[model samples]
Target chain A: MGRQVPIVDYLVLDDGPPHLVAGRCRGCGALYFDRRNGCARCFGTDFERVPLATEGTVRSFTIVHRAAPGVPVPYASAIVGLDGGGLVKANVVHTPADPEHVGLGMRVRLTTFPAGHDREGTEAVAFGFEPA
Target chain B: MDATGTVAPSDATAGDEVWVLGAAMTRFGRYPDQDLIDLGAAAANAALADGGVSMADIDVLGAGNLYEAGSGVGQRLQKQIGQTGIPVYNVANACATGATAIRCVYMAIKAGEADMGLAVGFEKMGKMGLLGAKPPSGEAEAFEPSGRYGSVMSVEGRLGTTLMPGVFAQAGMEYAYENGGVGFEQFAKVAEKNHRNSTLNPLAQYRKEFSLDEIMGAPMMAYPNTVLMCCPTGDGGAAVVLVSGERLRSLSDEQQARAVRIGASVMTSDPWTEGDQVQPDVNTLTRQAASRAYEISGVDPSDLDLVELHDCFATAELIHYDNLGLCAPGEAGKFIEEGGPERDGPTPVNVSGGLISKGHPLGATGVANVYEVTTHLRGEAGDRQIPGARVGLTHVIGLGSACCVHVLEKANA
Candidate 1:
């Protein structure tokens, strides 16, 4: 099989269930999906690699009917509070893009799907949350 | 009597009084044929005439413009409106560009750097679409990984791209989810009120009024935000003339009468964190800036005669009413429902129809608000005038998230 690539640098594609990577502040335990220079809360530079939980709860969501050129419309965007720690914004998949259907406090699990191709035509993968 | 009976021979301090001698704005709408400099020059010339002064009297130029005309915009503006080779500075703080330019001149005059200054803001939003994110460069790269760049590179950012309306719609959704379920109807009420207010403002882009039902039934761009609730992208410019108190004495009595004292001007930026709630996302910055303005002006929210605030979206106006301390938290929707922010209400807001109806020209918006407030304070607002208006406030929040608040009082009041 050809090698697969993750769309963003923070996602880890390995054996077993794929996990999202994050930086955890050693001082205040604040988690960030991206690399950190210092903790905004404790102002500490010490950080450690931590994998984010796949399950999370939707804090809020919106059905974006309009978007940039080439991006599909009427997709549901959400702020998901991770069960492990940290918060992330992602698209909701396998769920109808309706207010009544996708709602706050809804349980969801992280899942990866084929996004598009890179310059070399290798298949790239993107992550999102789906109704648990 | 020390020659003039006024306090004399005092050393100039940073706290020295500053006055807005004049303010003017082009009617905010699309001007496909006009360039940004032309818009800036027209507003600047009108402001100079309104202040009863000529370009030769302006000691410096502070200009604000968002995009397109890259560097040396101030110099270009001066070239268009008679360049006296005065020192010129260009300021760009996204939507708060105009207000930031005003603050720059205010600081200069306050520090006695110059007795008279001209601040102008112009922008031509050529097209309305999603704002693409550019890669961070140089020093910005060090901090970019931890900031918005991180969010933009995340899985969420890749799944769906957001424009201005989407961002505000998310905030509105979060507000409803957090609060006891504020709905689209309340948001529609805000659009209805501002569109109605625009009917009286000749400079407003959308002068036709829309009923709440019509606004609610309008095309939905995002959940809870209809087409009517969003400010249209347009091109325009606004200018303000600032003079020191000592310099004010040299102007004609009629010019002095038209002046409005810049009691306080404060600007602040976002202290955002990952996963922080977004409804009151701008509250911390706005509160910090507005509190300082109120303290400096010695004016409370209840003491204001009128207010002109940034309403880029209908929901933004609702949230700003709380952010500016005009109402208690969770009371913004109720305040609107009771007609508390009408032209005749206890604290009139957006008496110039706000960005929703007046059109948002990015760099020009902040100064355009100043123009509206000055007209009201001078009792020269014609039919849109707030009766006995003595003090007014202008608040603007730009999205890389900066907030600017200015308090103005009738010069002699």
Candidate 2:
């Protein structure tokens, strides 16, 4: 059997529990997920790897019924404000894609599911926020 | 000293001013036959002809094109128009490319580097669906789970998209969530007004008027934004010629009478903000540019007789009403509902049908906006004219994010 792997480098799979990682600025305590050259807030050259919060509230979202071909539709793409700190853009999963179901200020927690495996039989796990 | 702390060119003391000598735009719609250079040369020559000037009179050329920026469009356009060894600036600032191109020429004339300059923005995007980041080219690379963007399959349905409609849909929704009294109907009205206004704009891409009910009933591209509300991707080009104040006096009385003074030209990028990281902050940079333009021109928002703002989507237009200081904070919903932006309303906006009905050819939009405002300021905008319009504003914002605002005034005003 092939090993399971996180979809993005920021998503820590082998860690104690599946959690996302961020670059916390040493200068002004700003956090970023993607690889950043330096802290935009304080321009600090140094950054400390920090674990990001799993639960958050939906700050804003859009129910995308149309997308590029082969990409699934009727998904609630959202921006979530993590409980402690940090904001991320992700899709709201495990919930109906509608304002009645997913909306602003809706509480959600990070969750992972297996995406299609590669030719090598390695399973790529992706993260999304499901209703908490 | 200005905001940048650089010793300013004391406008009051220097008596230096830049004026739009002439402006013109080709009809905005699909043109499968015309190449970028052909469209660019046409607009450039038409603007020069309108200004009663020729390429020999131009000192600099600022060409605005998004997709073909690397091809030195300005130089290529010169080959078709005239081969003058003037400095050419090829610019691509997302949707603001056209506005930025005009700014380059405006600044050059203001800085005394050139007495007269030409700026043209053009794009040949034919029926591109849903503007977003283009997928990678060439054969598909094997998905490495720990690669830069991670496995392509894993990122799917995980990371949100940067599609224009969705970005604007969320932006509009956020505005409604923060400020009450906005919904699908309110957003649809924005499209309806623009489409109705298009009926009067002969050069518009789509001149047929659509009722509010019809707009609301159209196919939805994203939540709240329907196919009718979104600006269509098309091919078009626009251009302008700028002259220094000193050069204006040397021209004929008719030429001088047609000149529109460039009261203010300001471009701004997004300042750091917490919310900007998650959602595109189309507001802050716009507000900053608007305020700065007002300050430079000494013309308040209340003084604006007309406006041509970027309405790539109907939802974008609503929020920009507040961002452009056309209405009080949290009053944009009421502004449209009260018909404040209608053709006969207090502040007529997008009178040239805007990007919604006029068509949004990314590179051409900015200069086309300027062309619309100049047309009105010159009292030459037939049929859709705002009577005795003397002061006008043109604004355009690009998503990577840059915002450009310009205040234009009638020469005599």
Chain A of model 2 scored by TM-score: 0.95
Which 10 consecutive positions of candidate 2 chain B have the poorest summed lDDT? B1-10
Cα lDDT, all candidates: 0.80, 0.86
DockQ of each: 0.34, 0.51
Stretches > 4 Å off in candidate 2: B1-15, B133-142, B145-156
Candidate 2 residue lDDT tens string, B1-413? 23332223425533388889989999999899999888888899999999999999999999999988898888889989999899999999999999999999988987889999999999999877766545533233455545544545535345766688888988888788788778889999999999999999988999989888899888878778989999999999999999988888889999999998888899999986777877679999999999999899888898888999999989899999999999889989999999999999989999999999999999999999999999997788999999988889999999969999999887541
lDDT of 1 at B394: 97
lDDT of 1 by residue, A93-132 (tens): 8878877888978999989987655344456677888999
The local lDDT score (0 to 100) that residue A93 gets in candidate 2 is 91
Q: B387 in model 2: Cα distance from truth in Å?
A: 1.4
lDDT of 2 at B369: 94
The residue-level lDDT of candidate 1 at B316 comes to 79
Colliding residue pairs in candidate 2: none
